[model samples]
Target: MIISVLAAAVAPGAALLAYFYLKDRYAPEPISMVIRMFLAGALVVFPVMVLQRAVVLAFGENPFLFSFVYSAGVEEFFKWFLLYFLIYKHVEFDEPYDGIVYAVAVSLGFATVENVIYSLLDYKSFSQLLFRAFLPVSGHALFGVVMGFYMGKAKFHTGRPLGLLAVSLAFPVFYHGLYDYILIELKRYWIWLIVPLMVFLWARSLWKVNHANSRSPLRAVYSEDEVKLPT
Candidate 1:
């Protein structure tokens, strides 16, 4: 049972990691760096938990505010903070797609650990496992994809890095807040709202992945190299 629960916890996050890793068609990041980022993301969870607990104590049990401020705002802030400070300036983060790769790595890492804890502590049945894998786990991946899309633009576009950075954090927070709000505050039939939202998020994330890949400067460089090769 322990092994099964562990596998269930990790399955969603691992699947998402593979999906985003494959999206980097031009140049894949080093596995070591990705692993390190994943671990760092997991480590951040502990501090975030402490902070969230304090927020809960201060704010009481307002579900709407908690979903927006504490859950979405705090969690996304830490994830973005880590990405910006730790990985943004790295030499390997040259291409735009690298942003998506690393961001998804970090997000899924956090999601994996969170999922394990929730599964072990709260989950009572197979249905709960399936629901969490689809909603919370996959939702984190989608948020990472959106955040990374703007972050990639910020790194490569050079026209409006600050604006893109803002979007990177703000966009995810808005959607994440809405996601939790539906389930937390609205309740009942409102939970169905997340279905369309998830569909939209998935579509948008896929488009962003394609856009980032198409705009990769490395692709052009590789093309130039191929042109100079002996025929």
Candidate 2:
């Protein structure tokens, strides 16, 4: 039972990581660094949980405050801080698309740990695990894509770069906050609103992926490499 729960919890994040990692066609980041980022993300969950417990004790779980401030705000801030401070200027973060790959790695790492804990402590059925895989795990991946898109734009674009950097943090917090807000406040009615929000997130995340890929300085070089391949 433990092994099964572990597998169920880990699979969704691993699958999302593979999808984003494959999207970096031009210049793939080193596996070592990506794993390092994933570990870094996983390690932060302990500190975040402590902080969130403090918030809950202080605020007494007002739904809005708990959803936005305690959950989304705190989580995204840590992920953004890690990306901006540690990974932003690294040599492997050379292309715009690399941002998405690394950010998704970190986000999934956090999600995977959270999922495992939730599964072990509260899972009532396999169906519940499936539901979490569909919403919460994928939601984290989408949020990471949004965060990374702006970070890439900030790093590569010259005009109003600071604004883009601000969005890199602010946008994810807003998206994540609203996502949790609906689930927390609306309760059983959350499905009605969350579906539309999830659709928007998927649409927007795909557009960002394409935009970041197009902006890659190495795209032309990748094209050249493809051309040189023997038929």
Candidate 3:
């Protein structure tokens, strides 16, 4: 029973990670590095939860503060810090799309562990598991996409590296804050708003993935002759 619940909890993150992993079609990151980042992300959950508990105790759970500051702000900032310091300069991070690959790896790693805890505690039903899979797990992956898109640009392109890196961190925090805000504050209308938010997130994430792939220095270049009429 526990094993089944754990498997269900882990499946979504693994599926999402695999999806993003395949997106790096041209040059996939080393399996070892991806696993390393994933484990690092999982390890941070302990400290993050501790800090969140301290913050909640201090602030007494103001909805706005809880969603934006305690949850999104703390979570994303740590992720950004980890991605920047740990993976950004590694030899394996050689292309634009590599950013998305690794960032999603870390984000899903965190999400998988969180899901397991939730499953063991509150969300035992099948419907609840489905809800958690599509929303919380998928949400983390989308946020990672936003963060990685900008990080990739900051890494490869010379224009405005600092600014782009700043955006990498800032944008995910804003999106995540808004996402949590809808769930925490909207009460009855959260369902309506959340669907549209997820739609927008999926669209934006797809664009980011494609755009990052396009910017890869390893991307294939076509010659005019290669495109000339076959006749």
Candidate 4:
């Protein structure tokens, strides 16, 4: 990838993610935390990518079904593990809104690496890379957004957290499976299904965070000194 084209493709999303990490300017993680989150995501993704490939091989010609399995079952599972083990109990993860930002950071980090692979391996031109970068890349981030939102809810609900977490995972899996089905099996135009579903998930997560938790990511982070991060 040409350096300039790569910058053009990555900059917008990076900036957007950073801005949100900063909490629409309300509160932002330390730049180092932001960078750490990004790296955590990228580093974690390598193994997940390998798992995706292995699962693909197992499914062979029916790549889409296993594609769904890999994406929902494997990739999201690790990201969730990252959030749970590292982010969940941390001081940084205190507020409900914190969930959305950290989740997005992790997801975007994965997306960033995934983007480079797709760009370098799949595309011949910078423009093609730039165009496709926005959608699938954002898709990954948004998928995390969905997962994070619900996670925040489950963390605090205490009343019925497991059910909430289950829904959170199930919803994303279904959404992810549908998205892959469109792109690989059914034909990509059906991807419109992905957009609306993503929108709904985002909206739902935000609603839960805003109404249920009512704290920003910044406050959440600072709040964690007492909370101890989950191991």
Candidate 5:
């Protein structure tokens, strides 16, 4: 019962926290926008999850292969589509912060459903639940922030902002790819390699996001005629 409660609260809260954390210097995203992003993710994850499972089953049970193609590929692909396609085009996406906000929303939506299901069925102890609630789940949110921060900047810059936009997409795909690669492929005794790697990659991503964000021009998209960028 406690796990269920904690998961429900933290899962959604984590998404909000990510929005504020990245939007540190900006206004919070409107509640309506957040809710819409969440709904999009909630609806989209089903198809992505189904494809992931199917690919995993077809390509053999090798942990490395499964993590690379199925888990990392499908999951990241879905999230990317939601961000770059649906929400990226929204009017709220005017600010670079929008990228982070919506990205985290989608990620949390995925995490929330994942957390509730795991909490409902998995270990009974608070410690066990907490571990799942915080680490992997929270990690997922942070990763979304990491990815969103860049996507936002990219969107803001009109694709010619020193190639930062490209970096944003590439970094998340690589970072997330490495993360799942280590966890799912848990057979090797030297799996500890992923730990330091995650820390390093995450820290690097944070630095890149902050540095780039500081330069994001504070411009209003409300009055300016809406300029559409090719997705």
Candidate 6:
């Protein structure tokens, strides 16, 4: 039972990690560095949980503020901080797609850990497991993809770079906050909002993945340059 629960918990995250890993067509990031990023992401969750607890204590569990400010804001900030301060400047991060690869690694690490805890503590039924796999786990991946897309762009861009950097953090926070806010505050009616939101997130994430892959500098480097002479 324990093994099964663990497998169910991690399956969604593992699937996402695989999908993102395959997306890096130009230059794949080193496996060792990806593992380290995943570990770093998992480790950061403890601190985030502590910070969230403190926020709840101060704010007294108001679902509105809790979902938006404490839960989504704090969680996204930590994940962003980990990627920005640690993984962003690494030598391995040469191309734009590397951002998504590492970011998804970290996000899945966090999601896997969170899922395991929930599954172990509350093993209700198969339906719950399926729901969590698709919802929370996939939601984290979507948020990571959005954050990484901007961070990837920021790495190559010059003008208004800091603005892009800000969006790298802010966009995920807004999306995550809205996601949690609907589920927490809306309760039973949340499904109506969640389905559309999930659809939008998946569509946007896929587009970002394709855009980053297409814009890879390695592609140009590897392909033969075809400059036409004046005729």
Could you list the CA RMSD of all candidates, in the order they appear? 1.6, 1.2, 2.7, 6.5, 6.9, 3.5
Candidate 3 lDDT by residue in tens digits, 69-170: 999999999888899999999999999998898889889888899999889998648899999999999999999999998899899877659999999999
Provide the lowest-lDDT 10-residue window in model 6: 222-231
- lDDT of every predicted structure (CA atoms): 0.90, 0.91, 0.90, 0.70, 0.66, 0.88
Model 4, range 1-231, lDDT digits (tens) per residue?
A: 367656755665696586556553335456676677778988987788787788778776475666567676687787788887887778766556666777788888888877766765666776676566556776777687778788877776759688877765766676667666666765746657656766776676456545534544454565675488565
lDDT of 2: 0.91
**Model 1 lDDT at residue 87:** 92
Model 6 gets an lDDT of 0.88
Error of 3 at 100 (Å): 0.6
| Model 4 misplaced stretches (Cα beyond 4 Å) | 24-27, 191-231
Error of 3 at 208 (Å): 0.8
Give candidate 4's total backbone clashes. Answer: 6
> What does the lDDT come to for candidate 1?
0.90
Off by over 4 Å in 6: 225-231
lDDT, model 5, position 66: 66
Error of 5 at 47 (Å): 1.9
lDDT of 2 by residue, 44-137 (tens): 9889999999989987998888887899999999999999888999888998988898889889999999999999999799999999999999
Per-residue lDDT of model 1, residues 1-231, tens digit only: 988988988998998898899778887999899988888888888899999999999879688888899999999999999999999999989888898998898899999999999999997988898999999999999999998888989998758589899999999999999998998866678767989999999999999999999899999888888899999
Any residue pairs clashing in model 4, and if so which? Answer: 22-28, 89-229, 91-221, 91-224, 92-221, 95-220
Residue pairs clashing, model 6 = none
